[model samples]
Target: MDSLCPLTDAVIGDFAREDAAQLYTLVGRGARSHLKVLRNGLEISEMAVSDLPGNPNAVWTVKKNIEDQYDSYIIVSFVNATLALTIGDTVEEASDSGFLPTTPTLGCSMIGDDSLVQIYSEGIRHIRADKRINEWKAPPRRQIVRCAVNRRQVAVALSGGELVYFELDLNGTLNEFTERKLFNADIACMTFSEISEGELNSRFLALGTVDNAVRIISLDPNDMLMPLSTQNLPCPPESILLIDTPNDDGKGVAAVHLNIGLQNGCLFRNTVDNVTGAIMDTRTRYLGTRPVKLFKVQVQGRSAILCTSSRSWLLYHFQRRFHLTPLSYANLEYAASFCSNQCAEGVVAISASTLRIIAAEKLGVAFNVQSFEHRLTPRRIAVHPTKPCLVAIETDHAAYTEVTKTIKRNQMANDVEAMATDETEAELAREIAMNLREKKLDERVFGAPRAARGKWASAISLISATTGEKLTYFELPQDENAKCLALVQFSKHPDAVMVLVGCGVNEPLNPNTVTPEEAANRPVRGCVYTFHLSPTGDRFDFLHRTETPLPVGAIHDFRGMALVGFGRFLRMYDIGQKKLLAKCENKKKRYRERERKRKASES
Candidate 1:
């Protein structure tokens, strides 16, 4: 019962160091809250506009996302502070209107002593959360391509591997600044870490790429110019992460996960050392099995519990201390979610269509079986350092209460009820008209923003729900799994960064605004899933990227569990968390009835 994860509002960062129970998650736009979290099964707080100094324009900058993890309940994102979300323990927004970012919003999953948390975005000194907040200037030109912040400094990795590092003051002001040329490689992701006791002096960057290579570079405040690592791998790293382990250095270990095959498999054992980016030993191999799509699990000491694309559980261990380990196939068949030692009751996160805490106990000598489930399936799961036994829980709280189908169907009738008494005067009529219109501020746009309601091998599209305009389109890249592309806006703005993701055609598009038909026929437009979006106030077209496919079977306005399946029967999915929350079978009678209704409607 796996759900299409793209639609789930997952908080991907880490928990607080003192306590792993502090969870940070990403929610929908236009809501009164963005982050919904609870501690000890009690509602703690929801991140709202009260946390920032300003609200972003409803016309633009709506979908806020936590791109990556940094530090204590830390995250890096391009959020519209105007979001009606939480403002931590002691923070306030500039005004009542939701907008303005005050500080880091989410956390990294790894915990322990001396762990580093960082995030990157262009910010401006402005009134935020009532207390003059540094409004991160949402750039219409370069929408935060890459950013890395650590104990010593903050770095930004642009599209062309251009890196910028900044040292901040106590008041979060940039003090020292420097730039470097890290890679000619299309920089897919970048991270900064201080693997040594002297992080301020000894720091390095781990960069992942679609070109089947991971590059590690040295960071020196004096001669901080280029990378230090010289190793190259056959598999391109999709995510190069620096995490805390029960190992030495407290500096932790690095995991570079990538999609290693053409159409069949994934290489899960790509772990590296934090200090030296070279391949570590004792790598684990989970051969043949099946192909996995998306996987999220934590590494606890020598024990590695994994949930693959097959949605099965496999716990691996090795005698030697190295990156690789021998695979331990789970005699257990049903896989609920991922396994982690961080939970309160030795529970691992289990996901079907919904996410839940499934407790695990030693079934036999080398086998472990899970027990009961938790109260709620965490959209994002994490355990606290202070309370490793007590897990942090955030209810699958929706931005807004789910609107009933019957209520929505009767909106037109419920709304224009007083039409007969409306005035003819322009001002009076305008006022009346405004009162009758549905508030646009609360609309949930972009279930599938850039694409239309159709199926294909792959596609690209550009759509602006605000303007009801879907401009761009294309197909999947020949190289599946992972993709790296920049919109080749020919004879146009050189600064424009296009997330060019079309099928096969790597060629550029010529400058011409012909009819939609003409543009469609242009060889450049083949399966283009390009969405031309720019940060408000600027006039440069920016590219959009989606880690997973958008909602396929449901409409944009839908807020119910979509039973997404591969065969004739689909599994029930929890749309909010984005992970398959539970397994639900479609009632034969109900499904047949639905089909019958559709057939009658056509008649």
Candidate 2:
């Protein structure tokens, strides 16, 4: 497969230094609960913990006492208790007194080595390793729909389109900052930009609503939770992403690129003014027929966008040009989410029933092959000089019958001659003759002999090279097989490009009735058909046809002249005048002189 971008599956445990290599997830429910450790996407170990109650509402990995090493323990929180399972070790119970007995854990995040934040139906709780707990409750009648966390801030969206922001202090305490409600909308999804170096908070918050619009909110202390701008959309967005690019004007403010994936499978892109938050240079592209989901992934050490729809597509830059192509290796059917923080060079795709970790690498070259109907066999192709299209010669089953009949007739005649030879070969020839007789009887019992249907049918197809789609086709006359194809512009229609096809008459000869010399000297007839493509490149218009005395075997363009090759000779003709311009015969003297002149020029 020649691919514009190629991706390969990552080896198991490829991210030894990252948390992706040591993934932990809960399987089954209640007494059947099992903790499975995964490397890449493959399971490496499993431990059953029947003591844990019910299904775990939240699972997260917390670092152990290894500062320079990759070691972590799994934290499984249930409705009533929390269990800490050490890797390849024993399981111990943690303090669950801080959590409400009935509130389910909606999400979880780690702020530091000792602080863990868990989102509940009613509020958020900060649980430290030393059993100290701090909590914050939402306003009355508000339900949390989504939450996004960073090292220094946490943003939560509620059912009534209200957004709450919390600032995490140096000691891992959550302080209520500000809250705002989006008018006439319901929140669907929200995310905060990553905190950069020397920065104490995320710069921006992107929110998607059920009313088919997106709003950018400034996270700066001066304008916390303030709406910067809002852009209306045709469909509800399913995902949102914001990427920061370096400032090129030396203005100290970086430019942010906004990407939104919509419910109708279209991806929207624009530039967001970091200072003003105004959208500019908006563009939209259709990716697939299903709803689109976007994820920021790392490929070959650079950040790229992975869009999931009917099939997975990757958007990245190569040699200063951006390329968006389908990933050949990953088919994310009903994928729930993708985790890149665990694997920097690849991604771990999570679905309802499976987890797939795939690594991406660059391909030297990429090409696409599209298949046509199985009844037609493509033999030769010629590309159009000026259009993004090509012409192909295709044959059907009737053409196959014509060729098969010729071979069978020739073979039977040879067998008959062999039987009449010396007696030393009589036994072998007799067996061969018996097999042929059986085959003949079988053919008679069957529908019909191939000779009875030995009629060739060939067609010229106009295809788009850019998309590998067959636009239209022109079928030839019955019993004529296409031998060659060419795209040329004639003097009569110099501005128009046309297709020229060389066709030979299908005439099955019986070897038993025709002698070798008679077959060799038989008159061969063929025709050269010219066709013009319509303005839309969808259909072909008949121009004219020229009858030839010999079977036309090849066709080419000779400096705007039609160069036609018969069995043993080449002729150049002026198509407008229908006059022969030049002729070259296949003779020994001409061939020797041509070869000698070519060798002299090389020396």
TM-scores of all predicted structures? 0.34, 0.48
How well is each residue in 417-450 modelled by candidate 1, as lDDT tens digits?
4444534555564555555453333233322112
Please give the distance, in angstroms, between residue 92's alpha carbon in candidate 1 and its true position after superposition.
17
Model 1 segments more than 4 A misplaced: 1-132, 135-140, 194-202, 244-265, 268-603
lDDT of each: 0.33, 0.61
Output the lDDT of residue 315, model 1.
41
Give the best candidate by lDDT: 2
What lDDT score goes with residue 331 in model 1? 19
lDDT of 1: 0.33
Best by TM-score: 2
Q: What root-mean-square deviation over C-alphas does model 2 reach? A: 17.2
